[model samples]
Target chain A: MRSLKKKERDKLIGDFRSGSVAALARLLSLCESESRSRRDLMSSIYPVENQPFVLGITGPAGAGKSSLINRLLFVFRKRFERIAVLAFDPTSKLTGGAFLGDRVRMAEHIKDEGVYIRSMADQGRAGGVGAGIHDTIGLLSAFGFEMVIVETVGTGQSESDVRLIADLVLVVLTPGFGDEIQAMKAGILELGDLFAVNKADQPDAERTETEIKASLALGRSQTAEAPPVFATVATQGRGVVELAGCLLEKYQELGREGVIDARRSKRVEAHVEEMLKEHCAMLVASEIKAFRTKRAKAAGRINPYRLAGALISKIFKAENNAKKD
Target chain B: MGKIRVVVAKLGLDGHDRGARVISRFLRDAGMEVIYTGIRQSPEDVCRVALHEDADLIGVSILSGAHNALVPRLIAELERSALDIPVVVGGIVPDDDIDFLRSKGVRAVFTPGTPVEEIVKTVNAIVEEKRAG
Candidate 1:
C-alpha cells in the first residue's frame, strides 16, 4: 500500500473533484484505512455538497439483502443515473480477512458506467458496519452519486447502527427462517423504516407477511402511517418498483418534514464520536506500549487505572501546550 | 491501523480454489481485506478488479500450470492500466521457473509447504517499505 505523495494526492483530489471514476475508487481506498492519508483525503474534501440520499439495506446473511439491493438499484437507476453501492460482509472472527461475494449477486450492473459497486469487509469495528463506512458514504455522496445504498451484513442486534447513517433503512427477512416474532425480538425490526418480506414467491410468503404485519401493528404508532411493508421476490424483481416508488415518496415526505436534516446531523455526530473514540484508544495504546518499554522496573507495581489517568492527563496537557504555542 | 486491501485471485481455467481460499483466510487473519475473485478469472478480469478495488497487492494462486502464461499477462494488464500494485504468486510453481516469474515483476512466490506466517510477514514488509518510501 503506497502512501499517496503530496503531488499525487493533489492530482487525485483534483480528478476526484472533477468526477473521475478511477480517482473516486482510489479515494475510497484511501478512506478505507485509518491513516494520515485518510485524514489528508478527508480534509481535502470536507463539508460535502450535493449530498446523496443514503438508504441502508440490512438483514441476516441468508435474507437476500444483496439480491434485494440489486433490484432496488435497477429501480433507482431509472430515476438516478449515479448510484453507488457499498456492501459489507462480516470479517472472519478467527481471521481478520473476509471474502466479499456481493459482486456475484450484483452481476447485472457490472457494465453500467452510472453504477459504482464496492464491497467492504466488516473488520469487527464497533457496529456491524465497518468504522470507515460513514466516511465512505460521504465520499460517494461528495462524488456526486444521487443515491448511495449501503448493504450491511445484518446478522442481528449490533446491525441496528445502520440507522445512524441511513435516512431510510430497509430490513429484509425471508419466510421460514424462524417465527417472525423471534426475528423481531432483536430490536433490529424496530430500526427499519420499511420492512421487506423477500422471497415472496416461496411457500411461506403470505404467512410471513401476515406475521410481519401483525408485529408491526402491535408495535408501531397508530397516528402516523405505519412503515409500509412490501412483499418482494427480489430475485424475480417482483414488487421492487413499487417498493422503490414508496421509498422515493417516503424520502420526499421526510425531506418535506425536515427529517433528512436531522438524520444527516445524527450521522455526522456518530461519525465524529466514533473517530474520536478510536483516536483516543489508539493514543492510549501507544502511550501504554511506550510506558511498558521504558518503565520495566515499575511494570508490576503500577496500577492500571493510575497509568491510564496519567496518560490521559499527559495527552490533554500536550494538546494545551500545542494550543498555546 | 488501516486495513490492507488484497486481491486474491485464481487466473485462467483453474477450477481448484482450495489454495486460494486458504491463502485468503491466511491474509485475512493477518489483518488484510482479501477480495477473492473466485476461480477461472481472466487476466483482464483480475487486473480490473485489482484496480477497481484499489488493491495494495494481488495474490495469484495458480495450480493449473498456467502461471507461465497468465501471470505475465496479468502484469501487463496492470502496467497498461498504470496500477502500481505488487503481485505475489502461490501454488505449484516449478522450482526452476521461480526466477523467471520474479523477473516478470512478481514481488514474491510461495510454493507448497511454505508457512502461511512467512507469506504474511513478507507481504507486510513489502507493503511497509512501499508506504515508507
Candidate 2:
C-alpha cells in the first residue's frame, strides 16, 4: 500500500474526527498494514481521553464465541450509541493469508449505523490478538465509539494476552471442554474475569459449569468472590443478557477500585516494551542476513553461540561509532 | 506493508455459494486477506462491509442470476456512501451481461471456468491499481 501524503493524512484524520466511518475504516487498514504513515496516524490519535470500554471474548475453536458476540451486540447497542467489534481469525502460517469469516455470524448488525464490525486476520501474530490491535482499538476509541469488543482468534491454553488489552476478559467454554482437573491446569482458565459455559442446552453443560466453579473456588481464597460463570445458549439468546449485565457491572466495579487505571498503565508499559523488542528483532535479523552473506565464501562449522556474541558486539560497536560521529 | 484486503460477498437470495467459497480460498492462498460475507447479503450489507473493512476491492459472487439487479444496486450503494472501492462480479453471469456489468462500474466479470490464477491475477491488478491511484 502507498503511504499517504501529509495533506491526505490530515484530511483522513479530519474526516475520522467528523464521524466518517470510511475514514475510520481506512485508518484501521493503515494500522493493520505496515504503512509508513502508521506511526503518524497513531501519534495523532494518542492519549485519547474518551477511550471506549474494551471487552475481550476468547475461547477455543467452535466454542460459539462469534455467536455469543452476535447476541451481545444487540444488548450492547441498546446501551451504547456506537459500538465496534474487532473479530479475529488466524492467518495461515503457510500462506500468510486469512479467510475472515467472523462477520458472517454477526451479519445481522451489518446495516446498523451504530454498530461497526471489523474482521481481523491474526497476520501470523501469536498470543491471540493480531498485530496493530492496540492501534486499532485506539483509533476506534478516538472515533467516538463508546464500546469496543475484541474477539480473539480461537485460542489454546497459552494465548491469554487478551487479558492485557481488554478491560474485561470473558472466557467462553462449551460442554465437555474438561472436568475440574482440566480447569485447574491453568493458562486460559486463570485469564478470565468472567466465564460462560455456552451451548448450555447440551447435556453436559451444567456439569462443565460446576467443574469451572469448583476450580475457580479452589483457586480464589484471597478475593471475596471467584469469577462468575454463566450457562448460555448463544444462538437462542438465552443467558446472554445476564452475562452482559454482569460484564458491565464488573467493569464498573473495576473502575471504582481503580483497577482499570492500573491495568491501563501496565498495558502502556507492555506496549512500549513490545515495540522496542520488535524493532531490535528487525535490526538483529537484518544483521544476521548480512553476516550470512559475508561469510558465505568461508562456510564451515562455526559455533552459533560465538557468532551470536560477535553479532552483539558488532551492533554495539556500530552504535558507539555512530554516536561518536 | 499491508496485504490487499478483499470482501467476497454473495448478494441476494442466492444460497449457491460454492463459487464464493472457492474464490475466497483462492484469494487466501494467494496471500491476501479475504473476508467472505457468506450468502444472502443485500447490496447495502455488502457496501457496509466493504466500508468497514476498508476493502480495496469487492468480488460479488451471484450464482442465482441476480447479477444485473444486485450488482448495480451494490455499485449505487457504494456510490451513495462515497466509497471508491472497485468491484468485480463472478458466477453464472451470462456473457451478454458482462459489458453491462462493467458499464455499471463492475471492474471485471468472470463466468464459470475462469481459471483461479486468472481471478487472483485480476484481483491483484485491480487492488494494485487502486492503491497506486
Candidate 3:
C-alpha cells in the first residue's frame, strides 16, 4: 500500500509536465511499481503529448552498448537540451534483482540537469525490453524530453524487441567477438535500422565491418531502405558524430515517408491489446482465487480445463449483466 | 500492486560489492524492485537517485568505515532535499555506532551476518507502516 494517493500522484505528474525532474522520477517509480494507479497517472499525463524521438541501442553482451550510448549522448546533447535514457540490465533469475551499471558507464552526464538516466531491471522478460518500458517511454515523452534513448539488456537473440518500441534501432558489434558473423545471423542482424562496429581500433575491425556489410547486403529489408553500418571507436569517440547524424537523417526520412507514424500507430495498437489482455487476465485471476476459496477441495477433485471454461463463462456473464444495467 | 521500491547504494570509497549484491538479490527475491547504484557513489548522488526513483526505502552498503561521516551526511542531504524516504545502512559499522545511526534517522542497520530474510521482512514492515499512514 505504498502507493501515492490519486490526487497527489496527479499533482506530481502535473509538476513533472511542468519541468520538475523530481516529479518525473516519482512518476517513473510509480510506473515501475505495477500498481493500478500507474495506469491512472499515465492516463492523466497522456493528453500532454510531446513525442520525443526514441532511439534504441541493443546488442550482444559486452558489445559496448553503454559506452556507445555515452558517446551518443555527447553527440545528441549538442543539438538537444533535454534527453532521457532508459538502460535495462538483466535481472537475476534466482533473486530478480539487477545491477544497473550503466549509470556508472554514463557518469559523464550524471551531473547534467538536462540528462535523465534511469536503469531498469529486465525481470527475465523474453524480450530485451521489459513490460514497464513502454509506459516509461510515454511518461518521458510527456515530460517533454527532446529525445529518449533506450539501451536494452544486451541479450543476443530476443533483443529484436527494441524494434517494437524504438523509432530507430542501432545494433552494436565488436571486432573480437568469437562468433562474429555467426552471432549476427542469430536474428539480431535483421532488426538493425543501423549498425555500428564499435572498438574499431581493434585488429579485425575491417573484417568485422566487411562481414556485417555482406550480411546486410543479403538480408536488407525489401520494404524499407537498407540500413548503413558505421565504424566507431566509442571509447575514443571516433565516427560517432557521423553515426548520430546518419541515425537522425534516417529518422527524418522515415518520418517523411510516414513510416514513423505507422510504427507508432502500430505500437499504440499493441499497447492497447496488451492492456486488454492484462485486464482480462486479472479478472480471471480474481475469479480463480474466489473459486479456490469457495471450493478449496475442488482443486483436487475437478479438472482444471473444465473448471476454467465454467469460470470464464460465469465471469463474462456477470460482466455483461453489470454492463447492461 | 504497491511493489516496494528500494535503492541499494554504496557510499564513499568502499570497493567491496559482494554484500550489496547479495542484499539486492534478497530484496528482489522478496518481490521488491531494487535499483542498485554501483560502487563509489557520493551522498548527493544517492539522494538524487532516491528522489528520482521515488524509493520507499534506501539501503547503503559502506565497508570503508565512513559510517560516521558519510551516513550522517546522506541522512542530512535527504532531509535537506525534502525527500522523506527512509534510509538503511549496511556493511562494516562498529557496534558502538548502531544507536548513533538509528538516532540520526536511519531506519535500520544490517551489520555483517544479518539474515537476508530478516532484511526483507523488516523492509516490508517499514514501508507498509509508512504507506498505511
lDDT of 1: 0.84
User: Candidates' lDDT values, in order?
Assistant: 0.84, 0.89, 0.84
Tell me model 3's lDDT, rounded to 2 decimals: 0.84
The sequence of per-residue lDDT tens digits that candidate 2 reaches over residues A15-134 is 998989899988888887664367777789888888789999999988999999999999988899999999999999999889999999999998788999999998887889988887
Residue A193 displacement in candidate 2 (angstroms): 0.6
lDDT of 2 at A193: 92
Which is better, 1 or 3, measured by DockQ?
3
Instruction: Chain A only: list TM-scores of all candidates.
Output: 0.93, 0.90, 0.91
Q: In terms of TM-score, how similar is model 1 to the real structure?
A: 0.83
**lDDT: worst 10-residue window of model 3 chain A:** A176-185
Evaluate every candidate with DockQ and list the scores: 0.37, 0.80, 0.40
Angstrom error of the Cα, residue A141, model 2: value is: 1.5
After superposition, candidate 3 runs with Cα above 4 Å error: A2-5, A33-36, A176-184, A219-225, A285-317, A320-325, B14-19, B29-31, B113-118
Clashing pairs in 1: A97-B28
Error of 1 at A50 (Å): 1.6
> How accurate locally is residue A96 in candidate 2, as Cα lDDT from 0 to 100?
86
Residue clash pairs of candidate 2? none
Instruction: Encode model 1's per-residue lDDT on A33-66: one tens digit a residue.
Output: 7786778778778888878989998877778898
